[model samples]
Target chain A: MVDKSILLDNKKFTVGIFDDSDKLLHAVNTLKEKGVKIFDCYTPFPVHHLDHALGYHRTNLTIGAFLCGLLGCLSGFTLAYYMNVVDWPMIIGGKPQDISVFTSFIPVMFELTILFTAFGMVIMFFARTRMIHGIKEDLLSRRQTDDHMVLAIDNDQDQSLSNKDILELLKKEGAIEVNDSKEAFNTSLTSEEELTKILKSNKTSTKKTKKK
Target chain B: MYTADIRQPLVTGGKTYSDVTKDVCRPIENKPTPSWWLGFSIAVVLLLVLAGTLAWTVWEGIGTWNVNKSVMWGWDITNFEFWVGIGHAGTLISAILLLFRQKWRMAINRSAEAMTIFAVFCAAIFPLFHMGRVWLGYWPLPLPNAFGSLWVNFNSPLLWDVFAISTYLSVSLVFWYLGLIPDIATVRDRATTKARKFWYGFFAMGWNGSAKSWGRYEVVALILAGISTPLVLSVHTIVSMDFATSVIPGWHTTIFPPYFVAGAIFSGFGMVLTLLLIARHVMNYQDYITTEHLEAMTKVILLTGSIVGLAYITEFVIAAYSGYEYEQYAFANRMFGPYAWAYWTMMFCNLVAPQVFWSKWARTTPWFIFIISIIVNIGMWFERFVIIVTSLHRDFLPSSWVMYHATWVEVGIFLGTFGLFFTCFFMFAKFLPVINMAEVKTIIKDKE
Candidate 1:
């Protein structure tokens, strides 16, 4: 199942834009030291320390890849075994059942092992990231994927620290732009019922509105 | 104050991070240049030739080329191996270099990977048609079907090739496209036309640079690179096995696997030089793919070329030491036989030519390296021809042996595959940034 992008559903975030990674790293560490929760941080490329600063754990993609590789090995080996040994066993040079029979089969086994690992890790990553077709992306700024670094913390659970305090903290720590963006984005994929109902409601409000 | 090292600045012209985006996306923003049109027109015309020649061959039958009583495998197979070897450099550059954390690859990986995909396509066409009845291609797959309830032979090295090449092509495509996601999103945002946004957006698949998304992207790229290293190595080794497993005197040898792998890389880097030298000149990517990058690639060409040269010496020495008459004759015929000129040409181009790289001036001079690269390309094709033709021309029986040369159809088909390869490359150039913009931006500042 794809993980839905639900970070923007809530209206309580202080989006701090930093020009430099060092400044962003410094701000994330300071906020963590003072027990402020970091919702997310985005950059064009990964920063070395920001994950650790945000208390994010290492991903289990390697583990998933290992398991998938094992699956591929078994699948490849079984196919070779069933086709050669079990089904039509044609004797090429009187070595059909030799002990080293599968030695020639290593290349196929190796290929599938790699093939499965690549497919598995990527699919698992896509699921976890919620990057599916037609899904609306919640972009803080277009430059976030180009040159900008963004730090966002949901201001919901920590009610004592107001948006003003977070803004002050961000500005003091050298964020180029600081603002509250609890505003919902035009993201949710509209359902057929929701679309038709909205059209009907609009028609009811306006008598001359054309509706089929 | 931040000052880049003068001798080895990763990027020149003092480009900023934003400049990286602007420079990479410039070709996409501007309309296609006149030179692009000239190249594209040539490529398109050549593609028509490839299609026409294939139609002619299939209609007239495989006998259109003189694969006769003795030499069953000819130019088609040589072309296949050559293209496959050429494709190897792309995956090697992007996957193996990435695993080693050589950041220099970021400048050239996109174009190189695209080349890999296209070259593999060109490689595949030969094998597909080499089987006389191209329509019955699926007969090789294991299933209970029309060719009786027969299954694919698991012991066959050719079967191993099918699995290896298809897997390599698919995985490389996935890796290349996944790496382009964020960069495509940048294109999507900067697009002025509605058509550009729609096309780029559809491919980008909503890849916002969220922390979670970026984290996942890194993990996947790392794993893909790790797997692709083994995949790329095994692919050419398995291709070599198609010859090595055969009992042909020259083809059967223990050193074929490693030597083939080394030669593949040697030849693959040569092709990369040929394409990149032209690309950097035409696309104005000099700042990103700087002189240092060219020097570094020349060093790789020298190293791999040396290994291949050593492999040639090793093969000849072993053949001489072995008392088998056929083995000794095969190597001798390869050197002093009718095709001796081809053999020496291969030697000069593959071994003696790359030695010029020892001089720093040769490596730094783009035009000189470009000339050497073309020579290396020619040498590699001759190497394949020498291996296939010379060995086949002299069988055990003197009466059965016959000297063979490529018919016009055979040469036309060979020339046409280049058309197919370059056409795809031209299309990729038109649509995408040839450099990995997102990754390059990270290294430009070096201010962490």
Candidate 2:
């Protein structure tokens, strides 16, 4: 029941498409209590406190930003000190170029700190999220990025809850549409310059099995 | 999930999530309208004028302009300061407002931040071309050079500006592009053509709207905003220091930092109003942009205008109170001297024009706000011109004083920058989503 041509492995998912974020949030809470090993949830925009419902840990991107910012600060200071003092020091406007005159370095220091922190944090974000240019998108539904909030549950992984049981739970929790799909998600992305081929060649088509 | 009862909906007409994407991406998906083509053509023509004038300046050397020995920095530095100040409002809206959790900014921040990036590009052109030897632009960097391994002066505010402006531009780009990814992904999903899908999907970077990605996205956005808030304030402060650190009687005032920053925000809002007023009407973004957004912007224009007005009065008072004859004469010359017309024009346009916003009707009216925005832009330009020229023309030695008038080349180059700015903006509007669709979706009132 899997599209072997596109997916890295054969795994079936019971996908639930909800129209409202509130309903999706509620369903995630209830499904977790029912011992459903939900894979992930997708939404058009960030829903308030929905991450808590999914039991997702708070992202440590702030820690990454701080570490990068600290690196930037030191680099800024070193660049200024080495150039102005240790390498070649010239007195301009009668102000001596020395460690005592650290105030003059403040502007460059501030700028470098910001420059590095922004770039570094963004790089960390892209790498951690595995987001980059020229990667094929593994989408459950075309409307997932538009209006629909989707919850993808790996029926193979969750021995506690059957596929039918999860689909029933999703509909009871206010999902507008339910589907038992095998070809929706792929763990391994095609590292391709073949973006043009995706429209004509890819075999995965998101077919909705039932409407609630 | 619910907005406060008293707070007006940021996105009007009860837009749905899909509606937000549809409304914003329509222009990009369809053929360019006649209006878009018309604006683009005009901008391109003006851009040609800039190219011609800059070519003349470079080929003919610095003598092409009418800047005299006494008035060394004429329109070049004035325009540089003006555009830089223009850029501040974008960051203020995007970074500062985001930090304050002002949701109204979500509708406007995307365009405002785009303005900031384009405005900086325009600002950078002035200083870079003003150097005359544009090929040697890399000389500003603190690199070991052929001239005896000499490094740039750390004490010089000019050098500080080189570091500040480049850093500002790069950081602003990073911030803006990060905000665009999710919205670009929305456009990617809706794209029908293979070419459109490839390009949009390329930039969208495989964004699957994962809740985990969004959580990290929030954290990164917050930290960037935190750093950018101070970065925005520091940029204008450094620009002001270009004048304040100098010993020239009029330019050497301690209040220049706060005053210049206020004027930057004032002029920036003015420009934002000018652009958005035209965009909302032509693009049919009234439901998203709304009169409420216009009014909130006018309030900012009003507040910053007052601060700038106060700075003007304080400068004059401080100059008069100081016992130094040169300082007193500088203030008197600006008021009653040869350039009195320019000075009074600044005072009236900046100080008096914005006082009309005290009325709620004036604040909400788009046409009236547009006019005031234009007037604010003009006044701020004059503010820079007055500060640069009046002080330099009649410094300590009266014998060396000479009047400066901008040559046609100077005027054309200044006008050409508008071409550069508009051309970039029009292309941005056509190719990319002008509104932040993702953020707007979050604020859409869910019709349960």
Candidate 3:
């Protein structure tokens, strides 16, 4: 009964492809049409609307920052009040420990608010994105962090896929460079220096043409 | 479609990526020459003089400074205010300018941030060294100690300064360090030695230039820039309050906060320019720290200088219009009193001088701008001197009026602070990649 079922177990695989932002968008759209889910997109610089192309929703990081800021403000006020009024109240100047204390504590409160907001938002962001120390990540393109826009697609259907057809689609959509992740990683690990040399040679040839 | 390309020059004359790396890192990797050593030695000798003076002052007591009954806060306070004011520009350039999306800031922001840190460090020393009993400095902290002392006075502006400066230092460090991470990673990738690689690698936090990490880094940086912009403004505002909150003649004014802020950016940019002009030539980063960057910064200096000039005029007007004898006396004394020479010097350097930048030639020329920056710095120091000393010299009573001057010890310490600043800066230049390598690479790739 299960043999004829349309649903199949999800299998995770990382794919690396490079193109201009427009081409990447088109490839993403084509991938969406074929029911291929995008895992992530990596680029050296930000490409506008790329998140939307990958079907990513708005993140909660900002909301987290706001909440953390509120907490920071409360903590700052509470600490100042407790220390000045309740804990060890000593009237040095004519000013007393009352509402005026709030003004004095504003600097501390401001500092704490910014500190909490920044750290809290960043922590939430990293957690949501599954980025942690020493975690090995798939590289879509070496130049992605320099100039290229990379699309990392995860084909999860576990069905037999036409690799040649996918490469053709990528090429037709104006991909500057394309490579399968598994193949690239195997080549990278086995002969890392040779891989760098190949990249360097390719870069030089491109530079030579521009010189003309 | 691209017919213009055939007519246009194909190869732009600029250093390639490898050349860029080699040129920028030359000063760092190469050994110091005799000239470099000689310059460093002079700075060191000046630093030692400052140290000797500080030691003598501590041994003798706070009485070594020329602060008398009338003028309690003398040259020490003046220098403190001066250094702190100078420190403000760095933060303004790095944080505020970044938020405004000023692309020209990229050339000088790293060095400017470093200057801010060092200047703040120098400013911090004055308060502690002037405290006489430097060991008891921790009493300012809110924590409970063995001494039956209560919590810090939250009401005092001085205490507020302690909090503000410490917070500014910490946040600025984080902002600077976060910006340095990518560049440090670049250095790590280029390192040849195992030890150098390990340390740089450790600080680089295992950065692999992964797109996922870059995505996170960009978001965090944006958020930090957002937070730091307000924090920077608040810091200087709080610093200004150290004077503005006081009831003294020159000190008591609403115009002080913004005036101080403008002066800060003016001086800070001047310092940045001074450093970068030398660095660009010495380090061979003329392309990175381009003429366009200098022009943009020159515009900022001119704008801030005008604002400062307006503040000066407003201050005099406010004093005369207040109908208060002390305020009137303070303003008149600042212009036509014992410190008048210093006042005019400051006016000429900060207010009248920066007006030259209005001309295109002044803004575009690095050497001219560099000299102007030095003048602005001197003018800022004089501004602090005029404010602090001139006001205190003759206060409420005419009988208690007296002239005050900094002793040789005070001068040495002030010069020594420069030693501290430049020593750290020289070391920073030697060890770390002064430019944000990754950020620069991103800009370079944009041309592609």
Candidate 4:
């Protein structure tokens, strides 16, 4: 049997960041031409056709929801039937464990169907996204949930021949910012003072030039 | 191939993203003028009078109201039915419009749903108070125990109503809360204080704008909306059955269900318009609840009003054609009997007045719509009164027939419900984001 490990570490990635979606698309196409395996695209809101652009398959959440709903309906029917028919058989309005019992149970069944589907699909979603409770999140940009877009490419260290060639290619393909995982992780670990100083100087110059 | 644009804007003049937030949130963020407070205070006083009357009613018992042995269900039932009918418009605007993908609902749905929940609460009070022993109201539930209260009659429309109303209220609350979570999250992000942040954060359920969360939320909303659409329809249909199941002359009609549903939608839309018109102006959310939203609601009002008018005519026609002397007499009596003034007032308010919206000016002007909505509300209440009282006042037996009048106690509780509705609404407006900030933001990136 093949080993199925939940905690598998993938290789480090290089990402060419673009503020504009069109430039991001062009960079993605260039990476595809160079046979680079892209990891995933992170966007604040859903961008049209990004899944197709990234060659990701359609999600299986809906299939999971449908199966859960089917199970729910069956369970609801079985529960109602057992309660009404086998356990305590009482007739109301001349209707008993015939078709009317099933009909009467329809609303409950519908409610259960929805409940199961929702619960099932949500669990599947959390599982797929690796969002377990107490697990720290890896953030690319704080504004990724607000207004920024990031395209990440997965680069295997052993397979890659030249770092200079990949950087040149990304820069040539109109990347506003080029970054590797190692550099980003290092930059992210600095104390608040040093980080704030660097950010402040960059912002002051940008503001001054914009004003002029 | 040229495709016809299914995605055309509903209104000619469309509002921008910031405009929507500004328009809807205006009421909460800005302080109302002295005049607004003055009007609100007047409503408050009327509500106080209603409260006093209810206390008196409780003290005096069911006999305090002028409902006699013959007219056991009087103004209280009428008011219950009327308020419940008014409650329907909110769900119709929120759930039905959402299902139909009418974008204009975005402007009015929040206030409308609030109206629905509050109106249902007010409607519930009448039946409980009218029951004499309001404390033991839970005896109606279908729980079996050593206490030998018989299981609730599944066949009884009233029992069905308990299930229907409770279910509707619970589901509506869930739907409303689910819709509100994102906006609550927005508030959480904006909160300056630790206490406010904690409270809003708890309600927001650790939402991080993750695609997974959004996906789950969307699915939940779609499913809830699906459930609520039919649930809202079934609620009023079941309420209408309270009369339709009865063998009374005017009340026993097959047309009552759809007719009542239409009337409910009409009254509901009227209430929605009433709230949104004032809310937009008071809140300074001109951009969110715009002219186009008002127009869409006006169209719904006009459509439902016509359906109700048709029902009115159909009832008269059916009574005449059936050759049932009692039914004909009841219909004739409503138009030309002791309560002729009330009947005519209802007709003029519900039927004739709504026709003014055929003109663009009547639909577009908020003040005009507001006045008309109030009239429609009055008309709907009278419609209930005319149906319940006139039908019961003169039944098959001539000797037992009598005149029924709502004593001051009955009148007080009815007015008090307005206090109940508005007070709850005012509080809701003051606290929560009256407009859904998240849903509005989703449409902000529309290419159109």
Candidate 5:
């Protein structure tokens, strides 16, 4: 069970694909209300309030940036001071090596602080997301990042809602398409009208065989 | 249902997510438009001219240009300052506006950032070529060289400029690329062919846009914005110092830093408007880059133009008050002197042209803004000239004074840089999503 979280859980996911963001939001609310465990949501762009509506706390990126900038400031000033005053004394306008020249140091120091924050934040983001070089991940639909919003539920697991019930709920909550899937591949869902036609044809064929 | 915000629809015309993708990605995915082909051809021809002129300058030494001993720094430095100034708008729009949470930037920031990178690239060519033996240009770097352990001087403003410009370019590139990754992933997903898939996928780095990943992307973006705001300010401040630290009366003033920065922003917005007006029309992206974007940008042009004009006036007043004969002559000779035409053209273009934005009609009209932007561009070049030449030509001794004119080669090199700028811009328009796909998606109205 632990090994089969998103992948390798054959025929497990009941998927709901949404065309409109509002419809996706409403579906998310209803799914949460129905006690269905939503596997994930895939959107082309970030839907506002989706994370908060899904019950996550705010990100701590600001605090980390502040600390990194402070470090940059310290290093930038110290290096400039060390290089200019202590290491090699340049006689500018007959003035000696004086700390008063720190006023001039502000621009370079400011640049370095910004430089450090940008690099640090990006590195942190990469490490946190595991979005490193050349990793393979599947998108639920080709248009998932363009137009469609997808909601996935693990139907194979024991939960408060059944797969059929979840599918019905998805259709009720304005999902444009609903299908069953396993291992990230869609198992196309037949419409109810088509299902009835198949059943009726099967009954007629059985009667013909009986007559024969 | 989420209110569609039809009153100020950022994406405009009831566009869906797929529509946004289709529009932004159209140029990249499809064949080149006729205008694109024509523009690229012209740019390539101009670029070849740039190559020939640059080759001649390098081979024949800096003497190919009309820069004499009196006016040692000529059109090259002026062009450098102008292009660098134009680059500032991109960073300001992307990073500073992002920090302020101005949502309108979503539509134009991608192209603006691209503009910044290209402008910086054009600006860099001057300093490198000015070094003559461009191969030895790495001497400014803080590498452990074998030449008697000669180290880069940290005290020199030139060295500071070396650090400042290099840092600005690299940071802006990373910020731009990072912004592109998710969109590239989208492109990767949309690609039908193996080659398309591989190239897009390579750039995308398998960005799945997981909830966690999206959250982290925001973190990185916000922090980069925080860092870039100051870096942008420092870049021009340091550029200003290249002249400020000098004893040259026109160049040395306490107000140079802020004045140069304001001028940079002013000129930058002009270029941004120039490009966006043409881009929106050619690519049919009017829905995204609406009239509203143009109006907003014109306001920036006005504000910065005023600050720059104020700086010009204050410099004149201060020059008169200094009681130094050299300083007094510099400002007096600038207006009523032989190069008075350059001085007034700079004044008319930089200070006078943007004043029309005070009228509502001028701000809203694309054609007007485009015209004004061209005027401002010309004005900025003249401003640099009036500052550099007017001060240099008239010295303490009567024998030392000499007038300078840019030879055809110098003019060609300047025009060629435009070729470099446009060629890069056209290529970017062809390959990258002209409008950022990932960010624009967020602004789409999905009424709750």
Candidate 6:
């Protein structure tokens, strides 16, 4: 059961881009104070307390990691036990092949625990974040992943603020650039069918541009 | 956030956030430089040599190499230990240093972790081929099979190694790739060419750098670091157990775990120094991988080298104090017996050479450190050889006592692993941003 909030889905957002993380943080705080709903904020690097300013709860991913770790621990113990005790217990050099010699199983158990925890946590993270190879991203600005910190306000979430008013507010609070997300992104994220159509069109257009 | 009075700026020359991306991603963005071409060609030639030797080994069987009844585990095991030891600095720098809140690590950790992955790949080759029949390598896994439900030995340290090495490699890779995602996204966005955009975007996995994603990413990185700290220690400890559990005198010491772990870190740092010294200079990363960074690494080399030195002394002292004839003979034989040259070489390289780092100039000087780093790598390699060969060359009876020398194929294969390492490193440097631009941006003085 993946949390819906973790996914960055198709939405009409008024995106604000700031050059500095400090400025972005302040803009986010000011927007929150004025009761403007922030859809999500993206930064080139992690800005301290930006999540808190956006009124986001602390991520429960650690809890997921802990559970996965517990699963790994159990799996490790079970595999070792079943293999050594029940399956084929060969007596080598007069040493006992019973549970009393469980000390010997520690290394394998430890390794399995780490292996499972790491893989499991990463899988869970990817699943929750909707991050996968070759997926089309809704990039609001080219510099968003470079130097800019982006604050996106979904227009659907709060109908009180117009796109122009939001842009003005963002610019007033130190955002270098502000624009409607639809104008900025090449591919629209309205529906699955439309998305595929837009992607196919984008591919052909890119091919045409290459030819030219 | 104000700049702290006590802390020197991590990134010098007042680099802005955009400059970090540009500078770090320059190699990936631009055409390969002449130096890069030179290094890549050398690496490729070495890689070809590696491929040739490996194919020859596989085709000709273990008979191609020189392993005898006395020393069944010769250069194969020695090289295995050498490569694995070299792999340790990556995890130590990334996980252990991160856990300790060492900010200097941010500059070196990305490449160090990549080196860890490559070194592990090199290390794995020795053991895999050492099985003689490499096809049945899967036999170590505890699977119920047609041979009447035959399971791998749960008690054997060799089997423990199969689990430990695989786990270490996979976990290190995952850790490295997870760190690489945001940076990959940066490259994807900045990419101009259609091919670059497609490829980088694909690997970037639609990373939007959302606050929610960053929060989770931070927690996961922290947790992974916590787990990997123990995992790294356990890996070498388990590797040591392959020797410690045996009845052989020099190999059967209880101190092998801590001793091996320390030696691993020592050699690992030495290798890191060797690679990064070249990388920092070649890639124009002097500002990022500053003298302070080199100094910090040399300090680790000093600490771990001294620990290794102490371990050697302690092993000898304990062997003599134990009053056991076999144990005492092992130590004395290492120093005065047929392998005296190897023992003394290990002593000078691992123990004596690192003592020069006590001077600030020795630690700070790149040219001096580079030379010493190479020396340290050589010394660590000799240390493993001495431990494995000296213990096995004279076991119980004089009847089986025979001198061991590596055949040409064995030497070639050993040299080939360097090709495999550097080839992978060259590709990584060419394809990816060597430094973590996103992380480095956070610590940039004016930006902060």
Model 6 lDDT at residue A30: 82
User: Model 6 in CAPRI terms: which quality?
Assistant: acceptable
lDDT of 3 at B161: 80
Candidate 5 per-residue lDDT, tens place, B1-448, comes to 3354554666677776766876776677667979999999999999999999999998999888898888988898999999999999998999999998777898899999999999999999998998888888888876646755445556679888987998899889989999988888877665654576667776676566655567667767877887789888989999999999999878778999999999999999999999999999898888888887888899999999999999999999998999988888889999999999999999999898899999999999989889999998889888888888898888777799899999999999999999999999999999888888878887776321
| Quality of model 6 by C-alpha lDDT | 0.87
Better of 2 and 4 by lDDT: 2
Q: Candidate 5: where are CA atoms >4 Å away? A: A1-12, A61-64, A92-94, A98-100, A155-158, A185-212, B1-7, B446-448
User: On residues B343-419, what C-alpha lDDT tens digit does candidate 3 reach at each position?
Assistant: 89988988899999999999999889989989988988888888888989998988999999888888889999888
Which pairs clash inside model 1? Answer: none
The per-model DockQ list reads 0.28, 0.44, 0.20, 0.11, 0.24, 0.41
How accurate locally is residue B413 in candidate 4, as Cα lDDT from 0 to 100?
91
Each candidate's fnat, listed in order, reads 0.56, 0.78, 0.23, 0.02, 0.45, 0.75
C-alpha lDDT score of every prediction, in listed order: 0.83, 0.87, 0.71, 0.70, 0.81, 0.87
Ranking by TM-score: 2, 6, 1, 5, 3, 4
Worst ten in a row by lDDT for model 5 chain B: B1-10
Quote the positional error of residue A65 for candidate 2 in Å: 1.3
Candidate 1: segments with Cα more than 4 A from true spot: A1-4, A10-12, A97-100, A182-212, B1-7
Return the interface RMSD of the candidates, in order shown, one decimal each. 8.2, 5.0, 5.9, 7.1, 8.7, 5.5
Q: Which parts of model 4 have CA positions greater than 4 angstroms off?
A: A1-212, B1-50, B445-448
For candidate 2, give the lDDT: 0.87
* Candidates 1 and 5 compared by DockQ, better number: 1
lDDT of 1: 0.83
Residue A22 of model 1 has an lDDT of: 82
Candidate RMSDs in order: 7.6, 5.0, 6.3, 7.0, 8.1, 5.3
Candidate achieving the largest DockQ:
2
lDDT at residue B32 of model 3 (Cα atoms): 68
lDDT of 3: 0.71
